[model samples]
Target: MEEEVENILQKGGELFHPGLSVDCVIFGFHDNQLKVLLLKMKHADKWALPGGFVYKEEEVEHAAVRVLQSRTGLGNIFLRQFHTFGSPSRSDRKLNRELLVSLDLEAHENHWFLQRFITVGYYALVNFSSAVPRPDATSEACAWWDLQDMPPLAMDHNHILQQALETLRKQLNDQPVGYNLLPEKFTMPELQRLYETILGKQLDRRNFQRKMLGYGILDRLEERKRGVAHKAPYLYSFNKEKYAAALQDGLQQGW
Candidate 1:
């Protein structure tokens, strides 16, 4: 594995733009909470957003997709590029020093990685139950972390996460991208909870139902939610045709 990584890095360094990379903020909704996929750095306590350098021939968006797929074992998901972080001080000297010490770096390789980096940030929404997180060469472990319970991250990742969430909040009112984070079948209450979790506020149940149903993108199923203490609500699924139409028409105002 080490030899393979060394070869890949050498090739990538030859063909890819140094000091420019892509970072993915993969968001998931589960257990009435919002979560983000984070990777534990190999031989270190620091965690970082799943990210990778952009190949010289690759478009930034494609690079983001590649990074996401490589780190999370997911492809063709709902991905959106929102921001770029290029602060000169964003470099993590400690992490870089540790990595340099760990790897048998050639002179050229050392020069390549020691410089400043600017990362184009992208965020993806995925069904938590469907996502299979995978660690990349730089990481030892990968797992879902509730947004509130996230551990300290490497570099400017914490800032990147905040920017990603803000972008997501803006998207909620415009794009119907939230469906990517949910199960196939869900109840109004569950749907509302998802919105509330993202928006970070309590929404009136009555008003929430009315606005969501009014979108005309949901198909009410005959089946009801089962095995709950409270009254089982009717199940609903996104009407793909109508959802597409509504996306073209845009949302009726705000949720």
Candidate 2:
């Protein structure tokens, strides 16, 4: 453990660019609730999003992907850069001071860790069931928390989360990105529930079905969803081919 800490300190400058970092707001859906991944730091009560410094040679988006993979043990997921936070004082000093003391960082190491960071924010949609939550080297634990019940996050993460959710809401209307949060096969109600979770409102069932099906992005399968309380709804999968074509030609006759 001492060697590990030393190794991290030695490579700190080379492995991470001085002023830039990446913070990922990974959203998942399970048990009818939209969840966000949060990390508990060693000896810290404040929670944080899975975040890391960008390597000197890596692109920002790639760095975000690396951070997400390191924290969650999942990859090849849909990630999109939503915003960049470059406030002169984005890092919280009090939190960093306590964290540095807890980690017993050397003077130079503490200075490096407390430097001003302009973070690129990325939001990802992952299938919750497939995600194996893992803490990064600096964190003690990691878990999913419902968006409404999140713990007080360190830094400006609460603001970042709000921004990511707003971006996701806009994307849901313009893109078929919400399919990333779902299984390969799901019922119309399941899809509706996912949208409701994001939009924070109940969509009219018949109108939602008509509008979603009108996009020609869903492929209705003959298979019916099992383990339901009542009549099993038919399963449907998003058609990649159709979605790709629609992206080129525009959906809903360019409405």
Choose the strongest candidate by TM-score. Answer: 1
Cα TM-score per model:
0.92, 0.91
Give each model's whole-structure lDDT.
0.84, 0.84
Candidate 2's residue-wise lDDT over 1-79, tens digit each? Answer: 5457556655676788887888999999998899999999875778899988777788888888888887777888879
**Candidate 2 runs further than 4 Å off:** 1-6, 108-110, 244-255
Residue 93 in model 1: lDDT: 55
TM-score, model 2 to reference: 0.91
Give the TM-score comparing model 1 with the true structure, all chains together. Answer: 0.92
Q: Write the per-residue lDDT of candidate 1 for residues 3-72, one digit (tens) a residue.
A: 6666655576577788888899999999999999999998578899999888888898999999888776
